[model samples]
Target: MAGAFEEETNLYNRIVLGSLLPEGAWEPLPHWLQGWLRNYIGGTLVYFISSFLWCFYIYYLKRNRYIPKDAIPTNKAMLLQIAVAMKAMPFYVVLPAISEYMVEQGWTKCFASIDDVGWPTYFRNLALYLTIVEFGIYWMHRELHDIKPLYKYLHATHHIYNKQNTLSPFAGLAFHPLDGIMQALPHVMALFLVRMHFRTHIALLFIEGIWTANIHDCIHGKLWPVMGAGYHTIHHTTYRHNYGHYTIWMDWMFGTLRDPEEDEAKKM
Candidate 1:
């Protein structure tokens, strides 16, 4: 067991450090900038690539009529939302640094590699972490709405697109910095609760970033039991229902779930 662990650790070190830093690579960059590049550059790339792909998918879905397009935002509105998202970049960049700090402080358990734990355990941990995150965010999101001051000063910026088609993937992060941090607390919380592989941790962050945007794209469909864009679209429209992040379970349990299609059907 000890030998296997050491082998995995060596493999992870090789993959992460070997690829990130060639011999004397840091000599060219200042010490401060080295940390930024080492810790944040990959995350920034993930954000850019994920945001781009999500936007492209949104456009493709709309163009193909795979999704309805009633409340699509104007180019001006989209650009404004993109600008708002830019404000969140610094916050996003800092999160990984915080994670690294937690690991250094022995407050978080981050495995060196996935093979150190095997796929089944890794996936189980992933699902558990996601569930915990969803539960945390659900309550936090609800509180943001129920609390008058929080809603007005923080969350309201995100709710500007209060109807279908008024949102895009970029609008997902177009939030007040406080609002963005509050919503992101789940990721931080998960780090402490689970023994996550570093690679898995980064992958989940990538997924969370992309998924947050996907839910705002207004595509409107159920991705199995997971509530997709439709669930969130209603939240934007009504500002009261569907406060759960990924699943309707939390909303249903808390009696805040309001199915938009079902409600519309009832009117007829």
Candidate 2:
């Protein structure tokens, strides 16, 4: 057992430092093809589950409570409303991609064996992947807001859900079908540039899964409610600012984020 363990550790080290992973850990598919598969599967699952569940959730909310049905979607708007429920798909499709890119640039490496499964390595990689994903998404999303034609053609669909609440993430699905494809652009770039093994790719995906869902599923109301949708709501309602994708840190870094508190306090 000890000898077997040592062999695995040595193999992990070699793989992390640009050496080919042991035969069991590596494969030869073209990165683009691999990424294509990754994107398809990711996009498919997110759409399937999120769309069904969100619509159901929206139905439940509408049925149970009263948000002044006057503000509820019109019949025509209802179609759009349900459509936006598919927002989770883009997140699934876009995130595995960074692993592909970071590996290509040699900025990231994968390890197999025991160390890769440990908590420390998990968190470390989580931070690294999140930072990379946020950076790519932040700029791309900012462009979606700041750029004129693309926003009009591609992103306007998600604006339908400005109503607020758990269903808000559904707004993303109303996006032009092309908008879905465009969201994958970052992942495509990441896959082409990075060269991660499948395990790392899965880990990154898991991290992003929760964050993206929170953007719409849970991020509503005010900023003070701890990760409310207020910031993202401003993005959709006004479409002027707060283009950061997830982390407060990135929004702060880019100066694109809107902070109503600061402005309001100044007025006081």
Candidate 3:
């Protein structure tokens, strides 16, 4: 009976936390602490930190965008909108609704609870969902450009950055409400489709918030210190192609991985 109880307890902890813990680190903390961290701190912290960093980066991008080096420009107005999303979005819209939805479903799972899966398996499933989410954003971004009349109203704001800055990418969020919502819609759909583990759901959302903000960094477009980026900058530079927000695979697939000829002309 004791061993059975232990297994059940371990299962609960695992499902409540899908991807937060790495493989074989610390043992699980107590339930009360887990609840506090997951419910109170994690969600708010991710949003706030991502939002503030976004503001600062945008500010930095603004000061530097005008230079002629390999650098890009940032948009001031777009920065403010990113700031607004931090407050208006998490407080007014997303968190409250997600909380309520969880209660209604009686899932007790916070965001994307993984009730039965372990580490590799959970991430494997999550990869599928994340891919789906990325595809949605890719297509939506494509529509904004491919369609003419909508371009001026929906997509032009992001193009304000001639080069690329962390700030200018999010600055485009204020462009059109549809743009922000469209970016988020995929995650929401993925959660429903897979019954994501609650906390994982929240973590993924936080990732999206930070992921979008980071790619827009005015630097050479590396999402992190590593990884491929700059493609978004290519989009801003040419104002024609390379629209994926996260990874460049889609851009490469579509034949938009920066033009050598155009890069030279812009330099000239």
Candidate 4:
């Protein structure tokens, strides 16, 4: 697995960075720096592309169905969300890059391949990894609101888009740099807690960009266990419920879950 990772990264550096940097310069740089560069480029591209695609589909194509036309955020609002997110992105990518470096150095419980631990143990470790990450993220997110100082300083940047009219796919990553890292820190921390596939961990971190965009689109997927945009929009408005990350189980277990349907019933 290490060999495959090294080979893939080397090829990426040569093909991508080589075109821009002086010939051979990218090869001589340390491994961690190379990973960070790759992460920054890939992360930025995913953020922009995913956010734009989701926004185009929901805000334009399905606007009449999902949200009232008057409730849509203005073009300027979306651009501001994009601007804040872009500024914070360089910092946000650092966490995963550092995690990759740790895995390469054998500092974390990241396995090189599934064969190294066999299928049974690999699946077991995979379960543990997800549990740790989900639990950690739930608490981290909840505390960001529970603790007044943290909210005032860090989480407030995100809460600015606390309305259907203000929230959009672009608002998903429009957080203070540190705020974004704090929320994502669980993914990095889980590496030390349980064994995980090096590639899978990296893939999950990128998946977060897509997930966030989905939850901020103000369209309910109604997928049980999944924390869809319906639940998240309630969090934006009320600021006191539905603090779970990928799923609502954490909020449900902790007594903070607020069903979107409950909100609907109140209107009647």
- In order, the Cα lDDT scores of the candidates are 0.73, 0.51, 0.53, 0.87
Reference-based TM-score of each model: 0.81, 0.58, 0.60, 0.93
* Per-residue accuracy of model 1 over 1-268 as CA lDDT, tens digit each: 3343334434544455458777766546643344345545554556567767876766764464655555566678778887887777676656655665565455676676678789999889888888898899999999999999999999999998887667877777788877877887788788778877765665666677778778887877756567788888888888889998878989999899998679779989
Backbone clash total for model 1 is 1
lDDT per residue (tens digit) for residues 119-185 in model 3: 6667776777767767777777788788886678756654555554333445433435455555566
Candidate 4 lDDT over 151-249, as tens digits, reads: 999999999998889999889899999989999999999989888888788889999998898899888889998999999999999999999988898
Task: Please give the range of 10 consecutive residues that has the lowest summed lDDT in model 1.
Answer: 1-10
Candidate 4 similarity to native, TM-score: 0.93
Candidate 3 wrong stretches, greater than 4 Å: 1-48, 51-115, 164-172, 221-229, 259-268
Error of 1 at 27 (Å): 5.5
Give the TM-score ranking, best first.
Answer: 4, 1, 3, 2
- The best candidate in terms of TM-score: 4
Which predicted model would earn the best lDDT?
Answer: 4
Clashes of 3: 18
lDDT of candidate 2 at residue 143, scale 0 to 100 = 77
lDDT of 2: 0.51
Candidate with more favorable, higher lDDT: 1 or 3: 1
